[model samples]
Target: MKYSETINSLIRKGLNEVNHSINGHLPLSIRREILQTINEPCVIGKISISCALKVYPIWNDFFKNDTEIIGLIKQSEKFLLGQINEKELLGNAEHLEVFVQDYNKEDNIMVMFAGMTDVHAAYDVLTSGGMEECVSDEEALQNPDTWDTAFIASLAYNGGAVALDAINHDRNKEFWNWYLTDCIRIAFFNDKLPYPPTTSIVSAKYFSGNNIKEYRTQPNIWKENAECRSRMNDIKGILVKIMDITHWTKSDFYFYHVGTASYTQVFYYKGNELVKFNLDINISMYLSRKVEN
Candidate 1:
């Protein structure tokens, strides 16, 4: 009847539904492990049981559509649970070849951004001279539609001064300036922007030296910087590092980074324990954006 009780009831219901859905498919031990994970009170990465339940229908649709992959996942889960040996798991994996091909055919930006593998693919395409082929610096400066223009605009619209500070404070000031300038130059030659305008738009004046100074003098930027600093400092027992892309999926730490950024941070727990932190690029950008206002 009470609000807290209602939330607890919902969580229980969601966990029951998930357990029932996977029942008789995966090994009992595997199911139990998954249920334990789903029932955790705190967040995993950014995913919570409440959020997972709310999005169940969408994920269910995918499960139904890819029964083969689901089967493989079940087998994989069994292997992970020690119900099956590695040899047995590899035997089951052979059948995945056909399914893997079909799955690749359905790939798009949304899919690419969802998992670790796809994240790497997206990053590679964006950084491997593909971005340069799309827009030029001169064109980006002149046209609002250019990727360069939109990237700068997006930073400004999203809080460029804050973001600049995040990068400078968390990383280094020199890297921040280089990144900003490089993005501006690349936007000019870019034929298409990778992300939608709503996510990447920013003002042109922020790129100008005099305008940047005036913009930084605003009181709001300082306020935001203070708030962000407090939040970062509050994350005790977690160490953030900017490292190469290979570190994204490391088992020892929770990884977060924007593909556009040169490096990603691996956040390690105090005692080298594993935590199910979700890899969220948006959150990474937001936290990092809090640099010296």
Candidate 2:
């Protein structure tokens, strides 16, 4: 079951992941790794509420008189306490779904999406807990929701990125480091960030050989995407490829994001090996380094 395919499915999968984690069903980030240890809905509700509050300033600026949205959130909270029925809570979200059509697609789409999904993560996941599939970075980017802390934390980072982009459209690697680290800390670590468990090596016992499963760049799909065609890519083709074939996504071994110099490079870490690929054709021949285990 594709979680992001529909709101109900997303919620069901979210609930499922929290109950029994099989990996890949959650958001791409491992920050929510701890949530799997405890299958508590209230914790998710609390985190969702906090994320919404953190981004409230941005949402408020773009949308005033947000009564319906507020009601949806409040109803979500009520549902968590068993105060309201599922239909009542869902009715509220469904109503705002109509309004979000206008609120979305703006410059602050991430901001709005973060807030919208905030309500979703809180109320929907309380109902079910069964999801399907682990998508790679390419697919993960297209679908970013794990219906729990993994998702909420990821969206907080995404929304902040959009806001920062709106400001100056320039952010260095260090900023990314701080942002992701801080988000993980607040969400799972109780404001404590463990020094990254892995440094620079595919040789660590921490990773699997299949950390990066498949990667390829398809110009045909890029040309079909209006957003892709508009961007002035050197190759005029988008990098659309599967991530790790294992439980890990980029967020699992996500050390930090550093852009390649006039290049598009994708890195995947496996047990004691990190594979770097520069694609121009199919996935294998384009491998920058011979796969070593």
Candidate 3:
């Protein structure tokens, strides 16, 4: 289907922003080449179609003509605008079941799964365990809610991977490393913890685990340890300097699990009193690596 000039422009603008944000962290040489590749007319068509497929996976029906693709884009825009609810969004993602069949048959499953992971991760966070306590999509727009950590982390991973695909369809280790660091920072800022809890979050962990024991056994150890200090410094810089999430009013820190192997601790602060704390067990591996080194 031929989208109206206006609709086409809107879609382009929205996609450009996504591309630009993803490229911002890339090195100058790689970023320029990637932007050039993504800006190509043919590639844009594939990207648009891919994004549309994420929303409406009826391959035979949707891929038959441009009109169906246009409709898919419109549906996605509505979800973005908060005009549609989470129920509708998930329903649309379910269409991927059909979409995946063709993707796998064509040997493009890995590329497609990269995008699918984001949707599945978001779905898991919303429905799994205690994540339901996190805020809704509508609430997230106005304020940074605890759930935003999972939602955004999933997106960051997907976005980084997609951006890598655009460049050369190869995994870029540097981009992912930076992206993970940023996700941890953002999660910490939006944590929901109560102020002045009976026990300190960090202290409790120190007594319970060998991992924590290592850090606590040595005074100023994390500071003296280069790798540990670097990670801690990265987190501190993100919490104190980088993030602009001001909507979160709660003072809490809590551990949020993104997946089995990955988790993040979100620490929300109030006037420097350290009111809340979140520690993801996944971070223990990173710390463990540092301890070994």
Tell me, by TM-score, which candidate is best. Answer: 2
**Model 3, position 122: C-alpha lDDT score:** 32
Residues 1-293 of candidate 3 have per-residue lDDT tens digits of: 23235433443443344445532233322322332333433222232223233222222222333343333344443444357776765675567534544554222333334334334433432232123334443454345333322223222223212222122211133323333333222222323211122233432232233522111011235656787668665555545542356544443212222212333345565555443354455654554443334
Backbone clash tally for model 2?
12
Better structure of 1 and 3 per TM-score: 3
Q: Candidate 1: which stretches are off by over 4 Å?
A: 1-60, 63-66, 105-293
lDDT at 267, model 1: 42
What is the TM-score (0 to 1) of candidate 1? 0.20
| lDDT of each candidate versus the true structure | 0.31, 0.41, 0.35
Worst 10 residues of 2 by lDDT: 252-261
State the lDDT of candidate 2 residue by residue for 197-234, as single tens digits.
Answer: 21233211111234421111112333466654354242
Per-model clash counts, in order, read: 24, 12, 11
lDDT of 1 by residue, 1-293 (tens): 12244343444443444344411111223222322333321111111111112112222333434344334444443443357675655555554443333443222211211121211222222222123334443444355333321232223232232222232222122222322233322323332223212221222233232443222222234345766557545432233232232243333421223333432343433345433455488755544453321
lDDT of 1: 0.31
Task: Provide the TM-score for each candidate, comma-separated.
Answer: 0.20, 0.45, 0.24
Candidate achieving the largest lDDT:
2
- The Cα error of candidate 2 at residue 214, in Å, is 34
Question: Per lDDT, what order, best first?
Answer: 2, 3, 1
